[model samples]
Target: MTMSLVFRNEKFSPDRFTGCIAERYQFINCDFSGCDLTDTQFIHCQFYDRESEQGCNFTRATLKDASFKHCDLSMNNFRSVNALGIEISECRAQGIDFRGASFMNMITTKSWFCSAFITKTNLSYANLSKVVLEKCELWDNRWVGTNVVGAIFSGSDLSGGEFSSFDWHSADFTHCDLTRSITSDLDLRSTDLEGVKLDSDQVSILVERLGIRVEE
Candidate 1:
């Protein structure tokens, strides 16, 4: 009955106190970290504010139009979820698994993905500005229309990945491997591509690294 009370089909308000309302609470767009929401199933939920989703299992959930700005989502499992219009800025997503997940129109700025696994994840139309994906797994992922400006993707294998319709200015691909990855028609006006693993063919178009005195 209390769980049903939380899911009142309205925005989550802490002031609407119900007494130890966690699993007691449901579908109210509320913050749920450090709460008694152990082993909860949130499907098609919408978050319009900073979340407290630490140590949560959001497995197989469909989170549409969720905004997770400035939250503490450390050690959360977002496996097999379809996230759209989600903003995960300033969150601590350490070891969070996004395997087989799809992301769209997401802005994950200043987020720390320390040792997070993001295998086969779809990041279309997402903005990852100033995010630290240190020692993260991005194997075989797609990046269509994704803006990863000022991101730290070092020692990442962006092989067989795609990038399109994103602001490539001031992006860094240093000390990373992009072999066999498709990056056609990209705007490299001021992209920092030092120590990137590319072939001679891919090196031709990215003449910005050549430091030669060519005609303007």
Candidate 2:
């Protein structure tokens, strides 16, 4: 049994709502600052507001199967969040911390995630379209079979990640770091790698793919 609670235009500041389950709730113009929402479950919820610029903090929360459409969730602390199968469309989630979070099969469209921390996070099979992740920390993150069409990843650290199943031709990776990143199986003939930072061994691997002969 899940206890549902709906909040509309309400201010929930400095409140602790731990381990609560709310479903199908509509949050409009709600302010949740300095709030501890650890282990809370919010399913099928809609959080949208154009007039307000305030975002909520969900540090260590469990927001599995939630939907956020046109909401401002920027600068939120989402470290170790359980956001698997979450749907976020046209939302602002810039500078958010998603370290060690599991977002498998999540869907995101037209969202802004600039400078966000996504270290050691699992985004396997996630679908991302027209999303901006510029200058974000994406170290050791799993992106196997993830669709990232029209996504911007300029100036982001992509070191130590498995990117073999990604479509590089449709995504932008200007000036991104590929140090110790796996790309031997990726087809980079049509993909642009200008100004990208790569390790010496990784460069050799890419050069060999271009039919270049190297003598040691």
Which candidate has the highest TM-score of all? Answer: 2
Residue 215 CA displacement from its true place in model 1, Å = 22
1-216 in candidate 1: lDDT tens per residue? 223333322433323322322222233233332232222223323222234433455555555434343333444556655554334433344445555444433347644334434444455644465555544455555576665666667766676666666565545566777776676655445566667687655666566545543353
CA displacement after TM-score superposition, residue 114 of candidate 2 (Å): 2.0
Off by over 4 Å in 1: 1-113, 187-189, 204-216
Q: Compute each candidate's TM-score over C-alphas.
A: 0.45, 0.51
Give one digit per residue, the lDDT tens place, for model 2 in 89-153: 44444444455455533247644334345555455555555556677667776666666787778
Write down the lDDT of every candidate, Cα atoms only. 0.49, 0.60
